[model samples]
Target: MQGLVQSVFDKLLPPACPTYTGLLPLITTLLQDRSCFRAALSKGLGLGIVAAAGLIKLPQIVSIVTSRSSAGLSKTTFLVETFGHTYNLAAHVRQGYPPSTYGDFAALLVQNYVLLVLIYAYSGQPALGVSIVVGAVSLLGGMCNSGFPLGLLQTLTAGNVVLVFASRLPQALANYRAGSTGTLSAVTCVGMWLGATARIFTTLTEVDDPSILAGYVAAAVLNGIIAGQVLYYRGIKSRRGTQPSPAKKVQ
Candidate 1:
């Protein structure tokens, strides 16, 4: 069975594009090759992280859409964080990372932008929501296609570290103030923590980009903080013997 799968992957990927192979299938193949198993494992983990990164924000998006409220979401945080993802996307592209590795950043950016727009729209700022959507698309397009300065790209890449903190701190604080997660998906918080933690190792393995590594490390720490806040707030609610408030009207 393993041999058959390997044969299929080889036929599908071809010699010219070994990097294009799916990570798990590649791992299975690597396990078959004793000499390079460690290296293959590392690369496989990195690819898995890349795939996971694309979905990290999904719970938050779904929570907002289903609840029709961006409660517990910080607009400023998401707006700034979306820029972080945007910068990461452009930086990854500029550095010539394979699409298999970095393409999900594009998907992540788009989804985050959509969430941002939704937040604004829910807040009764439809015009602002539309403007952010347009502005982010335009900026991302220019960054991807145009020959932007290397220094600027580097700066943006490095700035991702700060953005990671900026993104989650407000949300954490909001949770603190509200005394509840308040429509914030516990799944989102926990997933982010786990994902960011895994990203650190996977990044060190595949990307080995200093800025990107720093970004993931900081992101992991911040996400851990947010997860801690969620747990802490949950405890507080339990201690106070208070049940959750009824849902707010969907704006």
Candidate 2:
């Protein structure tokens, strides 16, 4: 029994042996610049979260592409997601902050772009058109930021949030109830969760603004919700005594 338990523990945990993993260089850099340690750790954590979320969404993307039907998804969610990322990018530029330093914004940019492509291929012209409009807004948002226009960034950010709560969240909830994601990619959802986790830590460590900190806290809560969904779906898949759905099959 002891031997069996030891074997289970070994299987569950990563090997203790250290290798020249990518994080080693990062750790060395942080050690040299102790002052930046918190920020670096936060960023690294955020990146990991984003990566995890992206991986989780793979099944949904595949399902959508293979089925060529978005029967269970909501168009409004994607619409808002596209705009939200663009606005976030614009907000960063307006603040003279590098998007690369902002995990949420960076992840959102990649996620929204991929979402647009997937929607176009799976859902057809209407979805593609909406994506294009959102993409344009995102581009223009950057331009608006170049001049550091007053109120523009705020307006965009506010609009983006409203759309997310009013449209995206509701649609996501509905999709959850449907037991299928329609055309929405599960990998993207997972990526969003991971990104949110990373962003929370990053924001807490990197930024001093009280408002931004509060926002990061809020994002953490949202990420929790997204992660819960992923887990729930996974549980459902497992309960049926069937093979886990491939990430490609989820789209």
Candidate 3:
């Protein structure tokens, strides 16, 4: 049985697992000792978040494509949020934080751009979509190869509180006005809310960056607002469905 576990770990785990980067050592020693409990828990949860991130936005994407609508989604919100993630990812990488803490941002970044393009495409703005794709590729490629200043990355990440509001308020306001989240997927909203909250805990455990911690804190609050809207609107829908019909007049 031990050999089976080792075989599976060898095949499934990444090449860096043996490097004693604090994560694998924790896993290996978890039963042998009870030290670093918080670190172990954080690493486990962080990896779970990364694994879940790939499919976190998938339902929303599928819903938009199936309905041919981008009704409740805000393009600007996604665009700005993607920018925030890009800057955060850059900072974490340059600062040499563990990938477990920031890996989800990398995964979510790709998904966000895909969703953004779909939004533009369905909104009849193919040119805008193409422009965004080109801009992101050129900008990120250059930043990666060239010396992306850590100061700028930190500044951008520090401003993520404002970025969070910018990314969520418009969508929340739209939901308020429409009395519905429209085409927004409840699964995605709730998932993101949960993710943000979990990120706050994990960031505290694994990362020492104040900017990243603050961003996750703000994100948790804003994401809760959107998720609350989903539940609130859903309840309203359920109540309306149960409303009694008025009696018809005698003929």
Candidate 4:
């Protein structure tokens, strides 16, 4: 197992990469102690899942930026998701979980903020986008210094289960209403579903936190819905293109 992890790391990362530099001793220790190996393996998997979560939104971000159109994207989706990430981070912090466990959520939350702004800007509400960016920065700044209660963090974490589920609804509804999925990347939806599924297993193994598990489950369901939408709409467009128009005579 140690050699497996090391070989995977070596293939994935360059020699000078910090991950390669630091992984040897840790992998060696995991090999020596049976119980320690199991725990460390779980934790390592969990951390990898967390890190992958941070990049799940990249496809969406790229679609919005290079395409310069937030057409099929949902501002509400990212807004609610951002809150979910923030609350999750807060809960983990209150529980005194190692920062590494929650670090990706924090990073992903920032990316979501950028996504929200890009959505607004590309959708022709530049001022609103700018305001949202400023507001988010201010809100984060204020929350950082204020000591948060654990109870509140727990409540927020639990509440996020519902929020995360609802987060994808707006985009799904928009696709339904427009009869198209817009510019929303199918990659983002599929990646999110996969990531959430992986997180559920990793969380159960490593974190064993029910609140977090609940959120991941809810998120996975919604991501599946969005992925379904992507397929459904693609078929709809394809059939439309193939069919003859009513006004035209079939030759």
Q: Which stretches of candidate 2 lie over 4 Å from their true place?
A: 1-34, 43-60, 103-107, 124-148, 158-164, 182-186, 241-251
- lDDT pick, better of 1 and 4: 1
The 10-residue segment with the lowest total lDDT in model 3: 12-21
lDDT of 2 by residue, 29-89 (tens): 5578654565545555655654554455556667766887666666576666655656666
Error of 1 at 231 (Å): 3.1
Report the C-alpha lDDT of model 1 over 46-133, residue by residue, as the tens digit: 5665677678678888888899998777787778877877777888888876554566577678778888788898899978998988
Global lDDT for candidate 1? 0.74
Candidate 4: C-alpha lDDT: 0.73
lDDT of each residue in 100-205, candidate 4, tens digit only: 4677777788778888888887778889987877877665554454465667767777676778867878887888898899887888778778877777765775
- lDDT of model 3 at residue 82? 80
Q: After superposition, which runs of candidate 4 have C-alpha atoms over 4 Å from their true positions?
A: 1-38, 238-251
TM-score of 3: 0.86
**Cα-based lDDT at residue 147, candidate 4:** 69
What order do candidates take by TM-score, descending? Answer: 3, 1, 4, 2
Pick the winner on TM-score between candidates 2 and 4: 4
Best by TM-score: 3
